[model samples]
Target: MRTLALRGGARVAVVEAEWTDAFGVVTRGRVQLELRDGEPGPVLERDAGFWLRGTGVRALRNPGRRTARVRIVTPRTRTVTCPLPNTWRNEMSSMNDSGVVARTSHTSRLRGLAGIGFIAALAAMVATTLAAALARAVGVDFEIPDGGETIPLPGFAVVTGFFSVVGIVIAAALLRWSARPAERFVWTAVSLTAISLVPPLLSGAATATITALLGLHLVPAAVMIPTLARSLRTRTD
Candidate 1:
C-alpha cells in the first residue's frame, strides 16, 4: 500500500502497485482521470472507481482547492491467456494438407486485405468532404483546379486509392515486421488521424470547421481500426 500527498497545487500521474488488482480510493484530494493522447488529452474527466483495472486511464492529476491524498493498489496477475478449442485438431489437419488447401487459405487472407483497401478508399472520400466544408469556412474559395462543378466521386476514389495504399503500407510494415500488430495499428491510427486534421487547419474555411474536422476524424478511425483488427484475425482457427 502507498499513500500520495497532493499539496495546494500539486499533480501526479496515477500509477499501479506491484500487484495491480489491489484497487484505489480517493481519501482526500480530487483526482481527475481520462485517456491522454500525445497532446491536448481527453476533454472530459471521470472519477475514481473500480475501473483502475484494465482501463488505460492515461493521467490522474490533482484537481482540488485544498491538499488531498489518494491510495493506490496493484494487480495480482502479470499476464493471462485464453486458449481456443479444436485449434489443435485444425493444426493437425493442416500438417497433412496439400498445396490446394494451403493456396486457398492464403487467397482468403488476400481477399480480406482487398476489403481493407476499399475501406481506406472510403476514408479518403470523407476526408474530401471535410476538406470542402473547411474550405468554405475559411473564405478562401478553395477547390481542385479542375474540379469543374459538383465534387466528383472519381476524384475522391483516386485520392482515396493513393492514401489508402499509404496507410496500408504503414500498417503492413508493422504487421509483417513488428511483433505487436495491435499496438502498432493503434499508434498508427492515432498518428494518421491527427495528420488528417492538419489539412483543415490550412483550409481558409472557419465556422464549424472543428465540428466538420472531428466528423472526418471518425471516418478514418472507423475505417482503419476495424479493417486492421480484422486482418489480424484468424478465420481458419
Candidate 2:
C-alpha cells in the first residue's frame, strides 16, 4: 500500500501497469475523475473506492484547494476481469465468486470558502472605512464622553481591518469543522455583531456620534456575513 497526495487543482494521470492491479481509496479530501474524453466525472469524497484496472477514467483531479490523499493497494497477481469504466462512481465490486459490493460517500469543500472569505474581508475593510468617512463628512463628531477622545479616521480603518480579518478567521474555522457552515457562521457573526453594539451604546457619547458608531460596527458585518455565507452555499464540493 502507498499514498498519493494532490493539492487543489492537481491532476494525476493513470497508466496501465504490467505487474500490478491497483485500487484506490480516497483517504482525505475529494478526487474528481477525468473521463478519457476529457470531461470531468463524478467527485468522490473520502473513503470512496475505485478500481483503476479498466475504469475509462484517465486521471484523478483535486477539485478544491485543500490537499487530497489516496491510498493505493496493488496486488501481485493479475487476472482477466470485465471491462469497467475507469470513471466509475460509488463503489468497487469484488470480482470473487461471491460478487461482494460496497458503497459510501462524504461531503466537504473548504479551500474555496477560505479564498472567498479573504476577499470578503478586504471588501469589508474598505466598506467600513468608507462608511466611517462618510459619517465624519456629514458633521458627526465622534467624541465619546467616557474618554472625551475623538475617534480618528485611521483609527476607524485600523479597527475595521482588524475585525474584518477576525471575521474571515471565524469563517474559515467554521468551514473546516461545521456540518452546516453557512448557517452556523451567520448565526455566530450576527450574534457577535449585536454584542459589539453594546460598547457604542455604553460610550455615553452624543446621540449622533453613538448612532454613527453603531452604524460603523455594522458596516463590516454587512459586508462579511452575506458574502461569506453565499460563498459557502455556492462553492460546496
Give the best candidate by lDDT. Answer: 2
How does residue 24 of candidate 1 score in lDDT?
Answer: 44
lDDT tens readout by residue for model 2, 1-237? 677999977999877562136767777877777778998766666767666555566788987668889777666424424333454332444443222122343224456666777787778778877888898899998997866789988888788878877877787776554545567889998999999999988888989999999999988888888998887655533
Predictions in order: lDDT: 0.49, 0.72
Model 1: worst 10 consecutive residues (lDDT sum): 96-105
Cα error, candidate 1, residue 124 (Å): 6.4
TM-scores, all candidates, are 0.39, 0.57
Residues 1-237, model 1: lDDT tens digits:
555666644555546443144444455634445344523222111122222434455555554345556554334434424221254235324542111111123345446665675676676667666665565566533342343343343554455556667766666655443434446666777787788877756654443544554555566566666777567433211
Per-residue lDDT of 42 in model 1: 21
